[model samples]
Target: MILSIALKEWKLLIKEKGVFIWLLVMPALFIVLFGTVLGNLGGGTQTLTYIDNDRTAASESLMTALGEQGGFKLEAKQAGELDDQVDRIREGKLGFLLVVPQGFAEKMTAGGDSLAAVELYSDGASDSAAGIRSALQNVATDYREQRLDAALKQAGVGDEAREQALQSPLQIEEKPQNATEGNAVTQVVPGYTVMFVFFVMISMIRRFIGDKTNGMTARLRTTRMKPLHYLLGMWLAYLGVALVQCAVLLGFGHFAYDVALGDLAAIAVLVLMLALCGTGLGLALSMVVRSENQGMAFVQLITMGGAALGGLWFPLEYMPKSMQTISHFLPQYWGQLAFQDIMTRGDHLSGILPSLAVLAAFALAGVLVALLRFRGFMKSAQG
Candidate 1:
């Protein structure tokens, strides 16, 4: 009997044209738009405009090194073009401007106590400005070392001593704790997947409200069907729908973006727990609202608000410390964290146990609340 009711619910959902748009079309659009646009923005190379007033072998050597390093696309402009370049930067046509001062090479190679400075003007607000500055600093360091080596050789320093003198006293080596930090695809796919899964709440709440207000539950009371069977059927149906939605989204992400699923079993557990939470929350929300209009309003508030505050729209690290602390109270935050652990951190199921426990607690709390209120809500509707 439960299977029959669940099948009926699934069939009815499939027959709705809007279901496809909500479950697939909208999510696909978001994934492609953010993944292609913002993802590229985070990692793409910057273009730099430069006026080389020195125009000597040293300056040419610096430009050659910058080009070979491949951090920035170098655009050489005459000194007269400085004003125009600055204007373009203000207009967002360029990111950075470099002025290699006259006698830069002479000053750099003179081996005197004086310091030579190359003026760099940039849009401090630009995303690529920091990286470009870091690359330029590295180039400057290499060039300074070359000049120092040449000066030392002219002073009759032996080859072994010159090499030893150039080496830094302290060397730091960096190793990535997790290899997937800057991957844009991994960052976005899990965020939107959790977002759309909870969106199923809208459909579930609508069905629940319709069942109560449209005499479906009253009619079912005349049959041998128990209320528990009816509720179980609805929960199972919605959970199935949520699981399918998650699978499809992750599958699309894998194929389109080459997103790696580190621990498939852990990811499956996380998705199942999240779906259970969604189903339970939907059921509880239905009992809280008296009408379809009320249900719709609550649906929008909870789903959209949860997605925003729960780290589905942006990473928690980007949020203020207070917001980050508050996000722990949200089920969506735990869901996203679990997904990120598996997909980004390459963690096994053990790593996500805490998040899973929180989600399970949310599911249990929601289901218990819904069950306790179901009888009262139905009686009120029937009366």
Candidate 2:
């Protein structure tokens, strides 16, 4: 009997164009779009103004290094116009500026104090500025090292001699247990999984709300079957669909795209938790909404907004420090972070316990709330 009801829900969902488009077509399209556009967008260039007061050989060499880095388009401008350039930066026309003060060339040659100012002007809303800043700082460090090398060479120290005197070089070797987890896609898979499952579940719940508002639920209740049985059957059906969809996506990521599934067992636990949460949330939403149309809007705002906050499509690393701090409050963020730890960091169960605990809490809370609300609705309907 439950199987028959589930089959009916499945058939109805399949027939709906919106559900079909969002569940299957939309996710596939996003995968393709991310692969095409964001795949090659990491090395974004920054527009920077160059203020070269001392056009010495060493300064010129530093400028050449910056130019050759190809991460920035160096614009030659005056220091006097720094304020105007800052205004341009505010207007989103520039990333940052580098100012080489007077006597910089002489100072480097004389092994004296050569102070160069790099004005990091960002709109504070731009992620690219951070990357540009990091890359440019590296270039500056290299240039300073080269200047030091030249000074040592003039003082009778050869390249081999300077190499021997270097002390305490920091070497950080990142070795990923699963190479796939090292990338953005692998780390973000959990967030994506949670987000899409929520989307699908929400859509299904909206359908349920529609059935309730249209008196289909009450009509069904008029039969010998109880409302709880109907709701349970519907919840089971939606959970089954969510599980299947998650399995398909994971399969695609693993077999087709070679995306990492670091620990299959751990991933299974996470997916199961997500399925439970989705089912409960979907069912609860069905009861909360007055109608399907209202549910649709609510679902979009809730699921999509949560995904964005949780860094499903992007990383929280791209967000500001404050935003990153706030992300911990989001359930999706906890799930995603746990997945990343397992997949990217090769973390064991112990390493991911906190995140897993948080996810379990969310799942349990959602389920309890849903059951309570569902029971209340059934009692009211009976009364």
- Per-model C-alpha lDDT, please? 0.85, 0.72
What is the C-alpha lDDT profile of model 2 across 214-327, one tens digit per residue? 667767777887666787788778888888877877776667557777878887777777777777777777776666777778788767877888877788889899888777
Model 1 TM-score?
0.88
How close to the true structure is residue 321 of candidate 2, measured as C-alpha lDDT?
Answer: 90
Model 2, stretches more than 4 Å misplaced?
34-38, 44-181, 255-257, 317-329, 348-357, 375-383
Q: Estimate the lDDT of model 2.
A: 0.72
How many collisions per candidate?
Answer: 0, 0
Q: Which stretches of candidate 1 lie over 4 Å from their true place?
A: 110-115, 124-128, 174-182
Per-residue CA lDDT of model 1 for 1-383, tens digit only, reads 79988999999998997987997788878888888886776466667678999999989887787777775678899999999988988887777888899999888766668677888888767764676677778987887788789989999999999999999999889988774674666767888888888788788888988887788888887789988888899999999999999999998999988888789999999999999998888888887877878878887887788888998877788999999998899998999898988888889999999999999999998899899998987676561
